[model samples]
Target: FMMKGVTPGPLLFQEQMPLIWILFGTFLIANVLLLPTVGLLTARIAGTALRLPFNLLLPIIAAACVTGAYAINNNPLDVGIMVLMGVVALMLRRGGFPLAQVVLGMVLGPILEQHFMVSAIKSNWDPLSFFERPIALILMGACVATVILGIIAHKRRLTGGDESS
Candidate 1:
C-alpha cells in the first residue's frame, strides 16, 4: 500500500471501500477455515521444531536470518548488520537482560519514528504538543507503568521477594 502511495488507514477505508470489503472477506474466510486446523496442529508443529538438536538448529536459524537480511536488498551490509545484531542479542542474553523488549523496540522504532516525524511536522515541530493528544498521553503513561513494573519485578527477583508481605 505504501509503495503504491496508498496508506492503509481511515483514508484507505474511505477511498477504497471495495478493497476493504475484499480484505475483510478474505480474512474472515481464512480465520474460519484455518483456525481450527492450525490450532490443532500448533502443538505438534511446535514440538517438532523444538525437538531439533540445538547444534544443528542454531546454524539453520542463523543462516535463515542472514539469508533473509541479504535477500531483502541484495546488500552485504544487511547480512553484516544482521550478524552484528545477533551478537548484540547474544551479549544482551548473557547480561541477563530481556530480549523481547529489545526485539520489540527494534521492530517498532522505525515505524514509530516515521509517524512521530509526521505528527511533529503537522504540529510545527513542537514535541510538547504530542502529549496534548489523549492517546499519546495514555500510551506514555502505559510505557512508564511498564518500566516501573519491570523494575519492581527485577528487584523482587534479585531480593527473592518480600516474604513478609
Candidate 2:
C-alpha cells in the first residue's frame, strides 16, 4: 500500500518507514499505551462521572443507525431489514448461538460468491474443471487440511487435552 501511495491516514505517517509498517507499529504502541490508560479510566469511571443517561445515547445511536441505513439504499426497506436482522440475531443469541458465525458469514459471503462465480464462468460451467486447476486444487487441499486439523483438535479436547497446553 505504501508503494502504491495508499496509506491509511496521517496518524501512520513516518519519515523513514513505509506507511504500512508505520501504521502497524503505531497500532501496537497505541494498544500498549491504552492498557494502562483503560485501567485507570475504568477505575475512575467506576468511582464517579460515568453516569451517562440512556435518554441521550439511545437517540444518538438510533440516528446513526438510521443514517447508515439511508446511506446504503435510501430506502426504508433497508432499515426494516436491519431491524429484522437485529431481532433475529437477538433470538439466535437467546437460543445459545453466538452472533460471530452470522457476522462472519455476512462479511465473507460476497467474496466467496464472487470467486465461485468467476471459477464457474471461467470453466464454462464445468465444475470438475475447478478442481483440475492448480490454484483451485491448492485451495481445496488447504480447506480439507483445515477441517481435518479442526476435527483432530476437537477430538483431543474431548479426550481431556489441556486447553492451555
Candidate 3:
C-alpha cells in the first residue's frame, strides 16, 4: 500500500514488523468500535438531506466538490479534471452504467499496472512466471471465480426478467 516504497516511522522502530502490526491492530479495533456510531450519524444526516429538493441540493454539492478538488493542490488543472470527470460520471449515470465499477477500475488500474510491470521486470519478462507463485495462482483462481459468478448472476438476472414479464 505504500506506493513510494517508504514506510514512515521513527528510525528506532522503522523495521519492527510487530510494532507495525500492533499499530494496525489498534486502528482496526478503534474503527470497529466506532462503526456503529458513525453509521448512525451518517444515516441521520442522510435522512435529513433526503428531504431537500434536488434543485436546491445540486448546486451546494457541486460547489463543495469543486472546492474540495481545488483545495487538494490549489491547482486549476485538478479542478478542470474534476469537472470533466463529473460530467463523464453524470453521462454514465444517465446511461445506466454502474459508477462504482468505473471508480474501482480507475483506482485499481494503476496499482495493477505497477505490480504487473514490476513482476515482469523481476521475472525477466516471462509472463507465465506471474502464475508460478502459490499466492499469484490463488489470486488468479479467485479472479476467475469472481468472473464466473458475475456471468452467472447476469444470466440469471436476464432470465429472471424474462420469466417475470
- Write candidate 3's Cα lDDT for 14-120 as tens digits: 56677678878999998998888997899999999989999999998989998999999999899999989989999999999999999999999999999989989
lDDT tens readout by residue for model 1, 12-40: 98998888899999999999988789966
Q: lDDT of each structure?
A: 0.91, 0.84, 0.88
Pick the lDDT winner: 1
CA-only RMSD, every prediction: 6.0, 8.7, 7.2
Candidate 3 lDDT (Cα, 0 to 1): 0.88
Worst 10 residues of 1 by lDDT: 156-165
Model 1 CA deviation exceeding 4 Å by range? 1-46, 134-165
lDDT of 1: 0.91
Cα misplacement distance, residue 99 of candidate 3 (Å) = 0.6
Weakest ten-residue segment in model 2 by summed lDDT:
7-16
Scored by TM-score, the top model is 3
